[model samples]
Target: MAVAAIAGGTFAFKALDKSVKLVVDGKTQSVSTYASNVEGVLKDANVKVVKRDDLTPKLTAAVADGGTIVLNRARPLAIDIDGVHSKKWVTAYTVEEALSQLGIDGGADVSASRSQRLPLKGASLEVTTPKTVAINVDGQAISVVSTGATVKDVLDAQSISLVEGDFTTPAVDTPVTSGMQVDVTRVRTTTTQEAQPVPYSTSEQPDGTMNKGDKKVVTKGVAGEQVVTYTVTTTNGVVSAKTQVSAQVTVAPVNEVVNVGTKEAPVAAAPAPSGSGAGSSGGGSNAGAIPSSGGLNWPALAQCESSGNPKAVSPAGYMGLYQFDQRTWNANGGSGSPLDASAAQQTAIAQNLYNARGISPWPSCGPKLLS
Candidate 1:
C-alpha cells in the first residue's frame, strides 16, 4: 500500500505541473509537463534547439504557467559577396545580420531581400560590392569607388553639382561601364549690349491744288538708333552660343512726308476759223496785222497755211490757225483738240514753237515767216 501510494503521489505532482504554449515556425501546440526551465520544456517536447536556432524565453529562463514559447529554426544561408560564394548558419531572422556575419560593410548593394526577414527554410543573397571607377568631367580625370547603377548615380554619389542648361557627353542616364569617359561641359551665361540702326519710314499726303500725277517732298526722312541686348553662353572657354534678349530704341526716326497732286487741268480755248483770222482778233482785222516774235513774221506764215480761217480742219487731221496737228498742239501746251483752243492760245503756242525751233516748223511756209 505504501509503494502504490507513492506512485499515485508522483502522478498527482505531474498532473499539477505548469502548462506552456509552444509556437514553432508559425505552428502552435499546447504542452503540459513538470519542466522547471525552457531547456526542460524543449527537452520534454523532444525539440533539438541548436546554437543557430532562434529560441525565445531563453534556454536558462524558468517556465511559467500558461506561458508561451517561440522557436524559429534557422537554416543554411548562402551569400555571394566580392565574387565569392560562402555558406553558413545564421540565428538572426533578418538579412542585415546575415550580411554582417559575412564580414561585409553596409557599403554594398544587396538584393531587396536584404531588408526582409529570413525565409522558413533558407535564402540566397546577391550583393554588388563597391568597385573602383574612372570618370572624366570637364576634361579632368577622376577616380572613385561606387556601387551606383548609372553615370548620373555615380556623379550624385560624389556630391557633384548640376544646374539648369548643363549637359554631358554620352548622356547622364546611360548605364555605367568600367573605364567610361564622361565629358561635362560647363555652361555660363553673360549679357552684352550692341548698337543697331533703325531704318526710317516714308509716308505721303494728298495735294488737290497741284497738277495731277505730280509729287513733291515736304520733309526728309532720317534713320534712328537702337540698343540691343544679347545673352551669350560659352562652353569650355569657347564662344558659340548667342541669343537676343531685348531691343530698345535710343532715337526715334523721322518719316518723310510727300505731297501728291490730284487736281484737274484747265481746258484750252478753241482756235479761230482758218483763214486771215489765224492771228486771232489781234491778228484778224487787216492784212497787215502780222505779229512778229523772236524776229519772225507770223502773219505771212499763217496766211500761207490757213488763209485766215483758224478753226479749219485739214484732210490730214490738222487743225487751228497754224495748221497744227493734235500731237503738235498738245506738245505745245494745248489740251484736247487744237480747235478746242482759242485763237489767242493757238497763236501763243505757235509763237512758243517758233521761238524754240524758229520758222522751220512751218516747213513750206517757213521761208515766208522769215521774209
Candidate 2:
C-alpha cells in the first residue's frame, strides 16, 4: 500500500507539470511550470512584466502543455517634433519599427536612419515632415522642397555659408514650417584708407590803418592731409555701417593769419535822394556783384554748406546755398523762399548773414572753411 500511494503522487505531479515555449523580445526559451495560468507561468519563470510590456496572450488564459508565451519588453523613446517635445514607451526593436508602431509617416525627416536598431535603453529621435519654403538671399529668391528639421539644415543643404556678422531671419535653430519665408543677410566687411583734409586754425592781428569792418588776409590757410582707416560693413551689397578705426596725419596744417581793422570809420551823412529815387534797392541790385570779403573763405563755406549747389534744399527745411532755415533767412533781410532766389542772390544773402551772426548759423559747416 505504501508503494502504490508514492507512485500515484509522482504521477499526479508529472500530470500537473507543463512544458511551454517562452519568448522575451523575440528570444525563445523552453519553460517548465506547474502554474495554472499565463501570469503564474511567467512568475514561475522569473520574468518581470510591466503594464507597458507587450504579452502575446492574456494573463488570465489557462496554461497548457506545448503553449508559447511571448513577452515584448517596452522602453522609453524620446521624441521632438516641430519644436514640441515628448516621450513615448514602445516595444519596437528598430527605428523603423518604432516609427511604424507610433503611426509616424515614413517620409518624415528623422534624426536616425530607419534601419538602425534601437539600443538596449532605447533611443531619441527628431522628425520633420516635408515642407515648401522660400528663402531670399544674395539678391535671389529660392524655392525649396525639403525635409529639414531646422532652418539651419535647410541652409546647409543648399551649401550656404555664414561668415562672421552674417545672420538669418527667424534664426538658424528655429524649426522649419511650410510656406515659411526666410531672409538671409550676408554681411561683408572691408577696410579702406582715405585721405581726409585736416582743418587749419586762424589767428587775427589788429590793424589801425583800416576802418572797423575792413579786413585783409595776411597768410592764406592750407589744409593738412590725413589717412583715415575705416571699417566698412555692408549687407547684400548695400552699405550698412562705417566706423573709423584710425587716423594718421600725413601733412601738418599751415595756420592762417588775418589783419582785422580796429579803427572806427566816420559815419557818412545821408546822401541826397534824386527825384527819380535811385539806389532804393541797393543791396538786392548788387547781389551778383558782391565780392568775397570779411577775412573768411566764402567760397569754401558755400561749397561745404551745399556742395556748391545753389538750389539745394535740406530735408530739415533748410534751403538754398547755405542751408538756411526759413526763420534765419527771414531774420537776415531775406524775403520769400531761399529756393526762389538766384544763385548770386543766395550767395549775397549768405554773406549778409555771416556778417551779422559771425558764422553762428552754419555751425556744422563753419569749421570746414578753415580746412
Name the top lDDT candidate.
2
> What 10-residue stretch in candidate 1 is worst by lDDT?
281-290
Q: Name the weakest run of 10 consecutive residues (lDDT summed) in model 2.
A: 277-286
lDDT of each: 0.72, 0.77
- Candidate 2's TM-score: 0.50
Highest TM-score: give the candidate number. Answer: 2
Error of 1 at 4 (Å): 46
Tens digit of lDDT per residue, candidate 1, span 1-371? 99999999999997769899998765698888789899998898998897778899899998888989999787788876644687878765678877786677788888756668887578888776776767666667899888766678788998776677677776888766656666777788899999998888889899986544446678988889999999999886688899999999999888899887676434333323344333333333222223344445655666666664555565666676687877788887778876666555666678657645777787677788778
RMSD in order of candidates: 16.6, 14.6
Could you give me the TM-score of model 1 versus the true structure? 0.35
Mind giving the per-residue lDDT tens digits that candidate 2 earns over 1-371?
A: 99999999999999999998999876799989999899998998899888898998979999899999998889899998766799999998778888999888778889999988776587899988788989999999999987887899999999988889899998999889999988999899999999999999999999998545456688999999999999999989899999999999999899999887787544222222221211121111112221244445655565565555545555565675577788888887788998787655665577667666677777777865455
- Candidate 1 overall Cα lDDT vs. reference? 0.72
Candidate 2: misplaced stretches above 4 Å? 1-78, 86-93, 116-124, 211-213, 263-371
